[model samples]
Target chain A: MNWIVNNGDLIGQLVVAHLATAIPPIILSFFLSIPIGWFANRFQVSRGILLTVFALLYAIPSLPLFIVLPLIIGTGLRDPINVVIALTIYGIALMARSTADGLASVDPDVRQAATAVGYSARSSFWRVELPLAGPVLLAGIRVVAVSTISLTTVGAVLGIDSLGALFTDGYQRNIPSEILTGIVVTIALALAVDFLIVRIGRLLMPWSRIVGAGGGRSARRQRTAATA
Target chain B: MNFLIQAFAFIFDPKHYGTANGIEVRLGQHLLISFEVLVIAALIAIPVGYLIGHTGRGRAFAIGFSGGVRALPTLGFMILIALGVGIGLGAPIVALVVLAIPSILAGAYSGFEAVDRRTVDSARAMGMNELQIVAKVEVPLGLPLLIGGLRAASLQVIATATLADYVGGGGLGRFIFAGVQTQDYPQMLAGSILVIFLAIASEILFSIIQRLVVPAGVTAGRPKDVRVKSSRSRAALG
Candidate 1:
């Protein structure tokens, strides 16, 4: 009660700042990792190593990355740039592995058929493989998006003025609502972004849903059985 | 060069070995917090996941809940609960339990869901009761997936529990927070290193458990029914 009315402006600023820090990495990593994913999937020699690297990167604790990023990238400890860079790297690590896995799952027959249909390698990938890979890739992206949203708040530890500032401020000021607002808003933002990505994936590949619906009960069962 | 030297010294200091501020004390805190959270999460999530997956009615709930939990920012959640519940270890444990539940739930239910329908049917024909069938058939078959979920959930608890420092719940994160405040990069690095070691060690520990628990047939090279399961805690080969 007192937290919101008195700190309404502060919450608003934090939300905006939080979104600002969170979005760039999500967008950047999507573009950045697709190529990296493709390269990993295409090359037989380095697939294992590449994936292992990403997995290790993914496993690195977020707090350390947040702390260590400034030293690696030559930014101030509290700089939002440090947060963004660290997050972008984390996002890339997450997205690249999924991208590789997605691309790897595309049917060889479908790929050959695409090539046989007078498509160049470039066109075949963009038109054929990429679309085929969308559902899995988008599924991975949903996790990453949700993950990034959650992780972005970790940056506030280093003094980035994101929604995490609310946590710090609330704790400092002894205000529960401020902290509550931060939690609700952060979850809402994550859900909204995840929903948007899912919708966009659906729009991008209407045929998948049609195929899924047409495939009948067991195929759908298998889909549900795949786990998160 | 300086970073390496200082970080090594920071980690290896003798006085810091068994003191209140020692890495061992913090690591113990880390393990205790993670263990409590993982136990609580498994109890709730595994049962719920098994029931829903066994019944096959709560797929939507399971899926939606998994996504929703991932989206929950831990720091805010921790602080929010801490403010409401008041500080101590309790708030961080509650927050970590929230963070850990989804994958565990997904794993438990999906394990049951993935069991062969024919096997269950054959067991029914053999005059086995529902309890007997689940206890005998489903439990063994679904153990791998359950272990996988436990694997992910445990690591998540270990990784995320570091945030406990923010809410005054001490762990390795204390070093991280303290180091940052005082510009003690070596201490910060040491803390982060210890955390990473624990996380990786836990990962290896669980995978080994999974290998031992999962049967030879299930873990064997059966590429049939390949599906992408990008659960938050997917295991990776190092």
Candidate 2:
């Protein structure tokens, strides 16, 4: 308890640092995945290969990745950029898979209609296909967000100020209160971020509500409404 | 003969096999801890997921909640919880529960959502209550999806459980972490191999369960017929 009271500012610093390390990777992953997903969709390459590569990347434990990153970048303990790079590798894998899945799930007839209406491929993707695939893509985004939030902790062990610093400091000193403070703060952050993502998803994909209802009545109503 | 002797010697080494600081490093303990956490997470997650998937409001909540939960890093959560909870295995257990819940819920929800409405209606017309319908109709139909979710969750739990060793909780993670600390590449490789093997074994087991539990009727593509009958009944009811 005394430790937390004495070093409270450090806790805040850690939280900010963790966020700094996490956000960029997530944003970059979103951008990178867009093209990868489009490429996968346009070409008839084996999804099996794509998924396997992604899964392998996802499964590579964070600790080893963090260790490997510094060797490649030649930065020692001073910078958190390598941590971000390592974390982003995982994010790219996830986001790309999600992007591919979302695009694939887009209705074929909708694509056909867009092409029939003289919409170019780029416009159709941006305007029509992307909008319809919003729900699935958002679902993928949610997963990536959660994963990035979690992986940010690994950055702590590398001397980046974040929630993990609290855990490491508390562990090294055997200060239970300091550790507790960090844990509580981290969980709160996770929950808060998750809530925001859900809210955003709901706002972006209002049609999901009707789909959520999941019965013949809702389905029939949706079909009739669409035709009308 | 020299290579064979070295391998045997390494395998039988007391330092490799047992306690350095009064902690057991047996393979069984790791399996036990993982099994306990997986079974408990599944038992809780599957039923909750089923209920949520069956209802509209519940589905919304589950999807949102699960997404939120998945965003949390398991290692960080475990470390944090270990601090508050005062160390030992409890922290990792809680972390695993949190980690496993999202996949299980998502899996179960999707499974129920994908159920053929006609089959559900037939079960309903046959006078099955909600519980019966879920047990006899929804669950059987949703088995494959639910199994897939469980398989994914279990593998994740096993992999993440390696981190449990960080907080004095024993598992295969101890080998990996300790091996890294000492630069013992062989031990790290062995530990990773064991973890991967466990994950693959669990996947095979779940696949078998899925095969056994999914009803032959649903597997035969009877949902189309069931849908027609269900539509007629729903219209009549309306």
Candidate 3:
């Protein structure tokens, strides 16, 4: 109780820091990834190497990268730019994959038909392919957004205030309430973000409902069998 | 040749091994920790996923939650849990469990969902009990996806295990963390190289395991169904 009273301001500061660090990379990732993915889909040669690099970035440990970034750039927590850089690496990787998956899944005949109708290649991509691929692409975006939110907590370790600071403070002080608060808040934030994305996905792509609904039905059948 | 020898020497230096600190670098410890977490996560997630997926309620919720869980930066989760649970292996174990569950659950759910409805209906019409149908039909059908999920989860846990050192749990992470703290470039490089190598080795092993566990027929069987369903849904929408 005493800890919460004393540290309430700190908690607020931490939450603000987390959001600041997380949102930019997530938004930037979408911009960077979509074009790159479209290009990759159009050209087969570059896709493999680009994807491999992204995968490697994804595989690297977050802490080491966090520690290494300051060393590389000679910057400190006073600027959240370093965290943004590290988080963006993940964003690019996730979004790129999502873009590729979305574009690949589009019906080939649709592409042929658009070309037959005399649409330019670029116009066809923007007008035809991209719209059809929206749901899968957004699914990828939802993943990247949620992931970035969670990863932002690590920025707390580097002295940028955020929910992670709450965890660290609670741990250092041995205050269970503070720890619980951080955990609850972090999970709640993640859930809220995910829920919003899903809702938006449904709204933007009503056609996806049938596929989503079928996925649900089949999943239920699996559950009954597994339990039995 | 000199660089290679220097790297090897730095890697093998007894003083750098944390042995003086009573943390021996044993292959067995890594294997044990990785295997235990994988088994426990599978046990919990597979059944739960099967149930949730079978029930037809809130799949997006379950999958999204898992993705959210997976997205939680491992270091952050470890640090938080370490605070609650106190340092040592327990915190890392708990974190790994959380990390492993989502993939296993997603995999199980997707795997069973991918099973042929006609096959399931035929089994049911033939009067097989639910238990028998699941055991004989769904499990076989879902095995490949289930294995793929386990493979993914295993690789993730193994890589993330290095973060356990932050909570004072012994693993390869200790070397990596210590090298960072001390600014020992050679030590850091060596530790990272070893971690990466171990990760790759584990991934290869799991791939082989997946191949052995998931019959080739299952893989061949699924894509057609997935494509058909997706196309049908798209057509219905149009």
Candidate 4:
């Protein structure tokens, strides 16, 4: 309590830094994934290739990626941009797969119906396909948001600023409260962001609330679609 | 490209292998620690998961629990544990196992949940004991999801164990951390490449295991595409 109170301004600054590092990757990955995910979903061969590549990209550990990425992209070793770029890579890796899977979850007949109604490929994607995949995509984004917020801390060890600075500082200083503060704040931020995403999702796609609430109906519909 | 070539050279150099703190030794320690953590986590999680799946209780708790735990930052979690436990492999092991349990628990229970209720009921109607029913009916069918959980757990543990080195938990991560301190970019890149290889190998190995475990009769009539869809969806849930 004393540590937190005394260090209030420092903690505030850290939170701001954390948000700056985390949010861009979340938003960038969500938008960029749609096209990549759509491309993956559109072709049979490319789906396997793209998903595998992204999965492999994700398999690389964060610290190492932070270290090596600068060499590849010509950022300075300690540049905050390294964290942002690395996190965006991680975010896209997870979201692209989710995007592909979410898009895949949409029914084929629904696509045909949109075509019959004279919707072009581009407009149908924006209007019909993306909207229908909203729930699953929202689920994917929620995961990305939480994971990205947590991962931003990894940058602290590399000397990039974030809430994670507390962990290293606290550990070296032997102050357990500061470490606890970092952990608590990070988790709280993640859950709060997650809640906000859900709220936004509810506003954007009011229909999914009903489908999500009555999951049994959708499950049954999917079962019948499978049978048909 | 020059950096890449230097990293490969560093990896290929025979001087880095064998003996104390060699690449091979660090690699072995990394694998051993990951294996130990996975085993401990599985022992604790699988039985609880079984109970939940069998009794159809705690499903909501399990989901919420895993979700919250997943939000935890691994690096901070390790540092906190190391501070309490006073810095050793023990701290990281404890943290890693804590990190690993959620995925395995989800896997074990979800595997059982995936079994059709009608199938379990039929097995009961035919006078099979609960244990027999689980072993014969559920285990075989739920194997894929269980393995899926293990795959997720392994990937997570492997990635995280690298961070463990930050607190003096020895592994291949030593190279990356040590390289960072000395500004040795090639060495850092080399360590990253090795870890990536190990992770990808484990992924391929688990996938093969997943394919092999699918009961022949169960998957026989299903299209390959549907099989892929089911496995991927289960992954998305994780």
For each candidate, give its TM-score against the true structure: 0.90, 0.75, 0.78, 0.92
DockQ winner between candidates 2 and 4? 4
- Candidates sorted by TM-score, descending order? 4, 1, 3, 2
Order of models, best DockQ first? 1, 4, 3, 2
Task: Write candidate 4's Cα lDDT for A68-152 as tens digits.
Answer: 8888889988898999999999999988877887788778899999999999999889999999877778878888999999999
Residue B170 lDDT, candidate 1, scale 0-100: 95
DockQ (CA atoms), all models? 0.56, 0.20, 0.23, 0.53
User: Residue A99 error for model 1, in Å?
Assistant: 2.2
Q: How well docked is model 4, in DockQ terms?
A: 0.53
For residues A1-228, could you state the per-residue lDDT of candidate 3 as single tens digits?
776678778778777777888888988998899888887767767777777677667766665566455556777523578789988988998788778766776778999999999989889998888877777677677778887887777665445666877766766677767876776677677778778877987897776677557776423322222221
**All candidates in order of lDDT, best leading:** 4, 1, 3, 2
- Pairs that clash in candidate 1: none
* B102 Cα displacement, candidate 2 (Å): 2.9
Which regions of candidate 4 deviate over 4 angstroms? A214-216, A219-228, B220-238
Residue A227, candidate 3: Cα error in Å is: 21
Each candidate: what lDDT? Answer: 0.79, 0.69, 0.70, 0.85
**Chain A TM-score (model 3):** 0.84
Error of 2 at A72 (Å): 8.1
Worst 10 residues of 1 chain A by lDDT: A217-226
Per-residue CA lDDT of model 4 for B65-150, tens digit only, reads 88888789888888988888888798889889988999899888878776767678889999999999988988888788788889
For residues B1-238, what per-residue lDDT tens digits would candidate 1 score against the true structure?
4775787788889878788878889999999999999999988998788788667678798788777777778888888788788778989999899888888887777777666666677899999998888788877777877887888888778888888987789999999889888988888878888888898998789878776776666652121223424232222211
Q: Could you give candidate 2's per-residue lDDT for residues A1-228 as a string of tens digits?
A: 677778878877788887888878878888888887887767556565666567666665565456445545766533788778877888888888777767776768889999999999999999888777666666676667777877777656545666878777877787767767776777677667767877987797787666857754434433322211
Alpha-carbon runs more than 4 Å astray in model 3:
A43-53, A67-82, A116-118, A158-161, A191-228, B1-9, B14-28, B52-61, B64-85, B123-129, B179-189, B216-238
